[model samples]
Target: MKKNILLIGGSYGIGLELVKQLSEDYSVYVASRTSEGLEGTSATHITFDANTDSLDITALPNEIHGFAYCPGSINLKPFKMMSLDTFESDMQLNFFNMVKIVKDTLPLMTAGGAIVLFSTVAVGSGMPYHTSVAAAKGAVEGFAKALAAEYAPNIRVNVIAPSLVNTPLAKRLLSNDKKIEMMSQRHPLKRIGEVEDIANTAAFLLCEKSSWITGQVIGVDGGMSTLNLS
Candidate 1:
């Protein structure tokens, strides 16, 4: 039987791209609120809403080889403008939901299994108006590191911290050519990240190639987290 990979949200953007790329090599199962952008792929889709529903493991294999939590938020607002509810909402979606998924899936994961979580560049780079998202993603990073340590020699866990990828989640930021160019120029790479850029890293992390790598927060950003080219 093929190794099974359970993805929490693979219906759009980087998650969708990862599902498409991993389907050829693994049995891909995607649980998301909608199955948009997954047309013609070999991935199996199960209707799920992370906010309102729990993952049904009946669709997963008895031995899960890989898992990825692809759900995240990019709530940006100044400290004073951000409400307590805004922070709570971000924590609920980005932090709590991931913890829930991992606990629910840990039992079925096989030895050497990999768990990939999503974070944001803002978590380490400290950009303004990123308090909400950064806090939430920071929790993801911390959780991934601790989980990796406790589950070492069996299940490897890692987090991908990406900068402003051109996904539907960021449509407002990259709406026009002028805005796109302006945002792209902010990064040292001089271009925004494409879905493939992030997906490729995720694919590698989920495969046997990254067996020795664990407890790492890999930066798939366009050199934004560490580089300052002024």
Candidate 2:
């Protein structure tokens, strides 16, 4: 039987890639705020808005094999200039919204089902102008671990913390050649990340091959998180 997997916020970027790749082998259900005319013939698109306080969980399947929360924010600004509303908004989108979705979908997840969430390398290692996003993603890391521990032997939870991926979300950071070169040089790999780099990891985690992994924060940042080629 094809594994039933639901990808939230999968209209574009890594989420879109996952839907495309996974649809080849698994049944994929995509949910996002706005409808996306995705080209995957095998995937199903569902109307979902994470910002809404009231959501109908019954709209989803009764048994889900995997779930990926792909919603995120790239708000990078100085701490002094950032307002509380900005911080709260980021947290709501990246952390709290994910929490609500997982809670509502818990009953639908089969035994051994997994959950994957996106974070940023800034959450672990400090970065300038990343206070709001870092704080929000930091909460996701915490949530993943706690849920992983609590649901051990039944469900798996993991996070992918990436740096400078070339997605629409990061386009502003790499719009100009100078900006692109600056970001590329910051990492030991000498280039920003690609969506495939992260999407592949998501597919692995959702599949049975990574059944043993849980509560882990895997960094797909091209050696930026751990390596220093000085």
Query: Best by TM-score, which number?
Result: 1
In candidate 2, which residue pairs get closer than 3 Å at backbone N, Cα or C atoms, i.e. clash?
none
After superposition, which runs of candidate 2 have C-alpha atoms over 4 Å from their true positions? none
Candidate 2: tens digits of C-alpha lDDT, residues 20-138: 77988888888887655476356777887898854566667778999999989998888999999999999999989989989888889999899999999998899999999999999
Q: Candidate 1 has which clashing residue pairs, if any?
A: none
Cα error, residue 95 of model 2, in Å, equals 0.8
Q: What TM-score does candidate 2 get on C-alpha atoms?
A: 0.96
Query: What C-alpha lDDT values do all the predictions have?
Result: 0.92, 0.89
What TM-score does candidate 1 reach?
0.98
Residue range 86-157, candidate 1, lDDT tens digits: 999999999998899899999999998999999999989989999999999999999999999999999999
User: Which 10-residue window of candidate 2 scores lowest in summed lDDT?
Assistant: 33-42
Distance (Å) between predicted and true CA of 207, model 1?
0.2
Residue 65, model 1, lDDT: 96
